[model samples]
Target: MERETESRVYGWEPGEQAGRTVGREYAELVGGLLDGQLLDVTGWTAADRAGGVLLIADLGLYGPGGRADYAPDDDDAAGGLFRWRGDTA
Candidate 1:
């Protein structure tokens, strides 16, 4: 007899670019923290940019505890460079 196993849906893998288009469209975090990190901005639009948006980043430091908040670096929003906002918890 075969034992039952659990299946899970894992989102973007580590170091994986979240966006569909690699370099064409995506949010990349620059500077000291989260540098070179790419995020999915598929549906993100100008309206969202005007209101400001917060993105959650998983640093993988200590599981969920390692997650943190980050926002677009307004100075370079067009460049898709984000800045470290603060810790999640």
Candidate 2:
């Protein structure tokens, strides 16, 4: 998964809640992506947690341009994400 180019990271606040299962899945996904060095990852943060059943994990990822623009509405094309579409995604 080593990317050809370097990537950045960004954080996101779902503005609601991700619970535990979803958060764990998300964390695992992110951790895998990061460990594999897949693409130019952005929005990565050590604070991203997924332990409790009712908590908010401020996750992160790289946007289209390799930056956390916070514009979750931005298209996945602009970011490296496959289904990125704001917090609702």
Candidate 3:
């Protein structure tokens, strides 16, 4: 059966000299955390820096949905629930 998934997208920007090195490191880190094989779904792109490479990664979490069922109040003094979620930092 199909299930709802949570998605987190991250952009890895490795400066001109070490794109390949950075890419391998990131793949290893994620593989270790999931304890499974990591597939290479990466695409080639240019970074903002001259001659840099950009790798975009999409991390998906699949399971029963509960976190998205509730919405946070955006009028909090601390600038909403996202503030603590690292969206502002």
Scored by lDDT, model 2 comes in at 0.25
Ranking of predictions according to lDDT:
1, 2, 3
Q: At residue 51, give the lDDT of candidate 1.
A: 48
Q: Which stretches of candidate 1 lie over 4 Å from their true place?
A: 1-11, 14-24, 31-33, 50-66, 77-79
Taking the tens digit of each residue's C-alpha lDDT, what string does model 2 give over 1-89? 22222222223224322223212222212221232122222344423221111111234343233321122112333332322223311
Supply the TM-score for candidate 3.
0.17
- Per-candidate TM-score against the hidden true structure: 0.53, 0.15, 0.17
Q: After superposition, how far is residue 78 of candidate 2 from its true place, in Å?
A: 15
**Lowest lDDT 10-residue stretch of candidate 3:** 80-89
What's the true lDDT of residue 50 in model 1? Answer: 45
Give the lDDT of residue 81 in candidate 1. Answer: 59
Candidate ranking (TM-score, best to worst)? 1, 3, 2
lDDT by residue for model 3 over 1-89, one digit each (tens)?
22222222123232322223324321211221122222222452222211221222222232322111111224444311211111110
| lDDT (C-alpha, whole model) for all candidates | 0.51, 0.25, 0.23
TM-score of 1: 0.53
lDDT string, candidate 1, 11-51, tens digits:
45643423344333466655434556555566778676444
Better of 2 and 3 by lDDT: 2
lDDT of 1 at 2: 29
